[model samples]
Structures are given as structure tokens and as C-alpha cells.
Target: TQLLEQSPQFLSIQEGENLTVYCNSSSVFSSLQWYRQEPGEGPVLLVTVVTGGEVKKLKRLTFQFGDARKDSSLHITAAQPGDTGLYLCAGARDKLVFGAGTILRVKS
Candidate 1:
């Protein structure tokens, strides 16, 4: 089984601030995906990185995959209160293994 280690389990920041979250693993993966989830709702996929060193951007957010395919990072610029939620990274081999996730609270 693949295991993912996510850093800064919880983060609280003021609006318009920037923050970065990370997901790491010792095992390699075929693909990595990032998601955002709000209370009482299922996760919403933000981006999928299938190749090593891949980087994707969505509005104020940027997602990057490590060259080794064992790690990933999410950077959010000018964060807003609406961006507050759970951020998750899932790595896939034959199946998907998810990180414990980071909880972000962007206070206005």
C-alpha cells in the first residue's frame, strides 16, 4: 500500500495571503491528483498530474508534481475566505492512496 504524508495538517491565514501545502510518499505512483473539499461535501478534483515534473495552474492555485512522481505541492496565491476547505492529494498505482489532507482556513 502506498502512503502519503501531508504537511501542516491545519493552516489559518488572512485573506489575500499565499500558502503552499505538500504531499509526499516513499512509493512511486502512476498518477497524482489534487482535490478540494468543503463541509458535508465530497472532494472536488482540482488537477491531475500524470507525468513527473508536471505543473498545472487553476486560477489562483498552482499544482506541481515532483520529478520523482513521489511528491506534489499546491500553492495558492492571494487566498480568499472562499478557499477555506480540505485539500487532499491522492496517488494512484493500481488503486488510489490519499493523504491525510490539509485543512485551510482563509479568514477575511
Candidate 2:
């Protein structure tokens, strides 16, 4: 079975701080997506990277896909308290494989 591994399993920071999270896999994927989930809520898709080396940004958040399609990263700039949540990465091939997830807590 393929698996996605996320680094820094948990993160805590004061508001306006910056942080970065990573997701990696040994298996190649046709596409990869990032999502964020709050307590008691389903994950909300943040971005999808299909082409190798692709990068996308939403507000203060940035998403990147590795050139080999086996890794990805998410960077948050000046993180705010509202950014606290569980971040997940999913790889799509024959099926979607999800990472363990990174729990982020931003204090105000």
C-alpha cells in the first residue's frame, strides 16, 4: 500500500508567525491535493497540483508539488489564529491515499 507521510505532526505558533509543513511519499502519483479540516468538520480542499513543479497560492498559504511527484509542501506566512486546523495531503492514483496529517494551532 502507498502512504503519504507528513512532517512536524503538530505545530503551535503565535499569530503573524510563519510555518511550513511537508508531505512525502515513495510512490508516484498522478495528482496531489491539500486540504484543511477544522474540528467536527470535513476537510476542505485547498489546492491541487497535477504537473510536477507546480505551485499555487491562496492568500498567505503556498502549495508546491515536487518534480518527482512524490512529495509536496505547504507554507503559511503570517499565520493567523483562524489558520488553526488539521492539514492533510492526499495523493490520487488508483485510489486516494491520505497522509497522517499535521495539526496546526495558531495563537492570537
Candidate 3:
């Protein structure tokens, strides 16, 4: 079974807005990764959170890991059209378990 779950299967937002996406799981992961995929391509790794209570920032994007390492969140500041894509969260244990993903569309 998939160990990870992502919320907001679909999201539509305008430029300059802020939004947050969540990823949850019942099982603890050794590490968690966030990825963004565009049309006709594979997912590109955005960030990885290993330690509990870890927070990572990539430009306007902020990622946080729960204290238990079983959940995570991604926050985007000033949404942009370039940020439109499928956002995926993956948890690594014996293998990489990916959530269904959140499809985000940012319109200008």
C-alpha cells in the first residue's frame, strides 16, 4: 500500500497568492522528498527532509517536516504561472512511496 497521502488533489490559484499543500502518512519514513513535475516529463526533486522538525526553503517555496517524520507540508509564497505543475511527495523506507500528488495551476 502507498504509505503517503497528499491533500488537495487539484488546486487553482492566481499569481501573487499563497498556498500550502500537505502530505501525510501512517508510517514513519527515513526521509521525505518533494518533487514537481511538468507536462511530458518526470518529477524533479525539489527538496528532501530527513530530520524531524526540519524546514527547508527553496526560493519562494518552503517545506516543513513534522516532528514525527510522518507528515510534511509545502508552502508557496507568491504563486506564479511557472509554479503550475504536479506536486508529489515521496517517503522513503524500504522503497520510495509516492502520494497521488496535488495538481496546482497558477494563473496570471
Q: Give the winner by lDDT.
A: 3
lDDT of 1 by residue, 1-108 (tens): 329999889999999999999999999999999999999999999899999999999999999999999999999999999999999999999999999999999999
Specify the highest-TM-score model's number: 3
lDDT for each of the candidates?
0.95, 0.95, 0.96
Residue 15 error for model 3, in Å? 0.5
Q: Which ten residues in a row have the lowest lDDT in candidate 1?
A: 1-10
Worst lDDT 10-window in candidate 2: 1-10
Per-candidate alpha-carbon RMSD to the true structure = 1.3, 1.1, 0.8
Tell me model 1's lDDT, rounded to 2 decimals: 0.95
Candidate 2 C-alpha lDDT tens digits along 36-85:
99999999999999999999999999999999999999999999999999
| Estimated TM-score for each candidate | 0.97, 0.97, 0.97
User: Which parts of model 3 are misplaced by more than 4 Å?
Assistant: none
